[model samples]
Target: MLKFTTNLILLFISVTAFAQDSLSVETAAIDTVQVQQASKDSTVYKQRYGLRVGIDLSKPLRSFLEEDYQGLELLADFRISHNVYIAGALGNEEKTTQEDNYNFTTSGSYLKVGLDWNTYENWYGMENIINLGFRVGASTFSQTLNAYQIYNTNQYWNEIQSGIMGEDMLGEYSGLNALWAEIVLGMKVELFRNVFMGASVRLNYLVNNTQAGNFPNLFIPGFNKVTDGSKFGVGYNYSISYLIPIFKGNKPQKLPSNNQQEQED
Candidate 1:
């Protein structure tokens, strides 16, 4: 009977120990989940959203390198959403071109307004951008007819094209205007703290142009060249900019753990 009683006592002790071990394991799991939840609640990361302003470095460099070209442009953008930016540019240009039959100078100011969408997905803490954007551009300018040759196809009298001095023909025409739209593809890399360098190529289509009476506009300020038969033009700009952070936005919340949540449920 003593042996049977001792055996019962051993069995009771084993059961009690097993129960305590199970309780301890459950308590540990609960505490782990509570700590994770607290961490999630306490940790928050925000993204910087702000305005960026800069200058077109290409235009200034061109003006310095070329005697007949002078240009300046200002670029700016404001981040309104995670990938959307409201952007624009303002500039003035004066260029002189000498063609086989004519020489002309164009001078004017232009403005472009548009929006850019960042298409690239960046790693955390990186602000590099690949963007596709659109803009509506307008310009008010003047053209000076330097010189031209009138095409005379009549070789019967051994007379070919006749050269005419631009001073004799209406010298300068003012109050000319043009409007266009552009699609811009660009990339920007952050080179230093809040400083970025970028490049963009623009495909422009002419919407309307006010011809200067009898002289066709050979070159519109922002809209580069006007060929005899084409309405499309191409341009590019290299830029440097500084970003100003106006505010910060919370990043998207991470999804919860499935196993831990299932245990709690």
Candidate 2:
């Protein structure tokens, strides 16, 4: 009887130990699955980086509407970092203006290079931007003096018409150039998968100008109108662009708090 009772006690102890070990293994497997699911749910978001190319639509509309104006501008930008872009424009313009005493035409090509800083924060899967930028512009151009009337201080000689100058004063002046800088404020909105529409206002300051000996540079291609004594000018453009994505990058992630991390664990 003593031997039988001792064997029964040993069997009971072994059964209990085996049951506890099996329960521990099942608990560990459940914890591992929970951890994997949590990691999958906390994946980081990705962003696109690429080059965007476009044309200034306002230039084409103006060329169609204005009889004395013709212009074409092509613009491009590339993303170099988060919220920063390298941008540029290349264009050509020809314009004719009739002043009180003179008439002339100016034709030229211009190039502008710049950088843009974006200020907007986008939601997931959106790439809109509000940006402030700066540019340096250079132009090469020529001027043609079509007609002019000499200034006459004597009103009494108006009957004689000595102020009227004929074709003798008509001439073409070449090899003129100019340099300027501008501040740009703009916004861009994504219209479709890879299409965007944008607009910008610019404030320009003329840095240097090369003029003909006999005539002055009244207007520049990219710089617009030149006031008599002012170095400042204003301009704007509307554009539609398409993005050619180059690569993808993970967006910056924020760290969790201690309590949140403990809960996740």
Candidate 3:
């Protein structure tokens, strides 16, 4: 009887220890799952959305350095989505060009509206962008024929001196305008918090314009130099900008793997 009682007591003790071990294992599993869920929730990132305003630094620098050029440009953009922005520029320019046969001045104000699609994939907390963009540009401008020498194909004949032109030909041609479109490729780097520096190269295609009767449109204000019988031009800008944060949105977070979670725990 004593031997039987001792065996029964040993079996009961073994069962109780097994039950305790099983309960402990279940509790540990529940704790681990909760930890992983909390970690994922905490890892979500927040992105800033805002309006950014800037100035084209190259224009003012050119105005100061070049005697025949004066220009100013203001730029702005608003974030509409991740990797996309609505952007535009407003500017005024006056340029004097001395050609082989003529000297002319172009003065005008232009407006460009566009969208920038950022192609760069940034790391966490970085807002730098490499973008491809397009613009529709319009300008209202005037051209003045300062001086011109009449063209003579024959070298044997003495050429008329430059700056000797009729009064009608030396006057300003007003009420002139042009329309153009451009493809822009550029980058913006964040130099400081909410401050960015950017540069872009533009390939412009002239769509339409009104030309002076006697003088052709050799140079346009916003579109730059116009080639004879060609509808293409080129431009560039360097800018500095400031951002005003308006709101924030959540960015998707990458979750850790099981091994990483275990290591973290």
Which runs of model 3 end up more than 4 angstroms from their true locations?
A: 1-42, 154-164, 255-265
User: In order, how many clashes per candidate?
Assistant: 0, 0, 0
Residue 71 of model 3 has an lDDT of: 94
Tens digits of per-residue lDDT, candidate 2, 1-265, equal 9999999999999999999999999999999999886675455667889999999999999999999999999999999988999999999999999988779999999999999999998765689989999999999999999998887677784577647576776889999999999999999999999999999999999999999886788999999999888999999999999999999889754445557779989
TM-score per prediction, in order, is 0.79, 0.79, 0.80
* Reference-based lDDT, residue 82, model 2: 86
Q: Per-residue lDDT tens digits of candidate 1, residues 59-90?
A: 99999999999999999999998899999999
Indicate the residue-level lDDT of 2 in model 1: 100
> Against the hidden true structure, what lDDT does model 1 obtain?
0.90
In model 2, where do residues sit more than 4 Å from their true spots? 1-43, 157-162, 166-168, 253-265
Which sequence of candidate numbers ranks them by TM-score, best first?
A: 3, 2, 1
- Among the numbered candidates, top TM-score falls to 3
Structure candidate 1, residue pairs in collision: none
